[model samples]
Target: MTRIALATASADLEARFRAATGGAFLPLPPAPLPSNPAHLFAQLDGAPAPDVVVLDAELAVDHALDLATLLDEQCPQIAVVLVAEHGPDLGLAAMRAGVRDILHPQAEIAEIQSVLDRAALAAQALAHTVAPASSDAPPATGRVISVLSPKGGVGKTTVATNLAVGLARTAPNSTVLVDLDAQFGDVATALDLAPEFTLADVVHGSAARDSMVLKTFLTLHETGLHVICGPPSPAAADTITSEDVSQLLQMLSLEFRYVVVDTAPGLSEHTLAALDRTTDHVLLTSMDVPGVRGLRKELDTLAELGMLTPARHVVVNFADKRGGLSVADVEATIGTKVDLRLPVSPATRVATNKGVPLLQSGGRDPVTKQLRRLVERLTIPETVTAQPDPDSRPPRHGRRRGR
Candidate 1:
């Protein structure tokens, strides 16, 4: 049966709709419709999303159209119909917003039934076109690799970009890099990309709901690596929520083989949200006393929260023989094995300045070679015997001190 939902305040219209659907339609709150599709879905209260949504234009035509437009983009499978007094202007606007049909305010039960039947058919066609044929095979879930650091200037972005590019080379068009460093992120600049859209765009609109729409928002790199750059400005970052980051990462994991995330310095809420979905952690830090100590604290915190993954890797960047801090010192300080150490090289700075990754340049430099090793380490899968249940984990505390 075709499921229907309605948003209206008119008793007359509600009665007619109930009769038309034979009490089968779900009625939403009368006024102040939700701002977006997500908010609307939240009102379902655990029920499945309806196949058709009917909006009454009497309360607010503009709000109805806006909601219709979002539904058109985010949930294309749901057919939208508007109830309004028919006019040339309203008809044109409704059509532009992809409303399936327009019904008059005094529509009778039979008329409403006829419109609903057509809308249901349209929705069925869309659902079939969007989804593939059913099979016994399980749905594919991609690997989510999040590169994190306790402080800035530890070559985190450099490693993330290189790893993503390397993976893309190995599996072309199968990798995506997401810069979760929202405020002051430089992933776009590192790749010399002038993005038409950024992370902010991907999390807020149709991109957040549809994998195909999300892919269109990503900025593609020359190495066949797709990227979701950070907000264009710090102010723009404020609009994104931790929930947005969580949803974005979940969607990417379903679409790509490797979802490489570049997080900000320290564990911000956004970074923590990414970690919740992460399968591996590339814990990076610089070769210095303070940096190493900070990394220790970060590791301790993650462990306490039960967020550490079995595939965790500790990477020490800017290794120097004369720095007096050996790899042993780092491993001892962080209480973890040093999985990889990248030597300091002038080539790294040059590549960053030119918006190119060392891996993309195919350099034979030691830094480049170490980065390749890190990528190889990731390629070797680690068996996940178990995952700590997030709900059972300890509550977070004092996480705001560092950020």
Candidate 2:
């Protein structure tokens, strides 16, 4: 549960916060907003630190901004959200102070809940980065695969569809594919699924409340993979945010063994967010000048932004010796070996138009064989001999003395 410390002086707003969180946050004493600016930080420091600190910007915008800055320096772990009327000065100051968001003080209850949920997810992500997982413990979290491309018409959806089908065969019902091309996604058409629920449904639904709730929102494919298609229309896509994707992935990670994301062509806000959370990056490019050049720039950007920590495998799709660019040339241009070269197969177009994955319908042809190899790569068993298990963590010295 996310613990939110509500520092607003308005009794009505405080009541709203309590109702909106719906017992998600830990109980705390009535918040004290010290009138004296000097004591504000000290007052907050004295209280039990919460996962989030929601400040009332109406009280003292300057003092709130300064206090947010101080909290960021002194208590960096705790997220801060300033609730104020939208204003240029306040928004700028809050951003400079590293506040999570500058929201309206009188926003609807649902809005406040969404903000709190997002803050909780951010806090959890921060913790995961800082805390080391026990080597003895098997990976209980799902593996994330992000299919990315710089320009349109390079077949990102095709790669994502085949990869998800391949993974589903390996992991069965423990797989999900998200069509994150919010405005324009064809995952449903690619697989011939007329999903009743798209990503918008999942976001609007209380799927975040429980992973099981999320399952109901998924469209089960004959391939044994569940899917969350993109918005049916572009306008609805605007309602979805990067924060929504972050929270959705976190929840999905708990339930599914693998989450394959089909991102829109080119980098968008949500695509970058998906990249931030991905464990594997299947960077797909065609054997062409623009595609090669775009992959280089994409690599440079991912490197600069620190998104390369995830294992990145560059796949040269539609590769052919006679193509304008050779495999060697493409590899030299990207500064990375071509991990997998996927040839353009006639079977691909036929299967896509038929709404079945090539991996499902191609029947062990060269393309399906290659797709199977990719799944085989992901299913390699971990070497347990190198790591200690939880049972071996404690010493048994006292028993030895008695013996």
Query: Least accurate stretch of 10 residues (summed lDDT) in model 1?
Result: 383-392
Which residues of candidate 1, in runs, are more than 4 Å off?
A: 1-130, 135-138, 382-403
The 0-to-1 C-alpha lDDT of every candidate, in the order given, reads 0.85, 0.75
Clashes of 1: 0
Q: Write the per-residue lDDT of candidate 2 for residues 211-319, one digit (tens) a residue.
A: 5345656888998999999989989888988888888987888778999999988879888778767877788898999999999888777665556643556778888
Query: To one decimal, what is the Cα RMSD in angstroms of model 2 from the true structure?
Result: 18.0
Candidate 2, poorest ten consecutive residues by summed lDDT: 383-392
Question: How does model 2 score by TM-score?
Answer: 0.61
Candidate 2's error at 392, in angstroms?
37
Top candidate by TM-score: 1
The residue pairs in collision within model 1 are none
RMSD of each: 8.6, 18.0
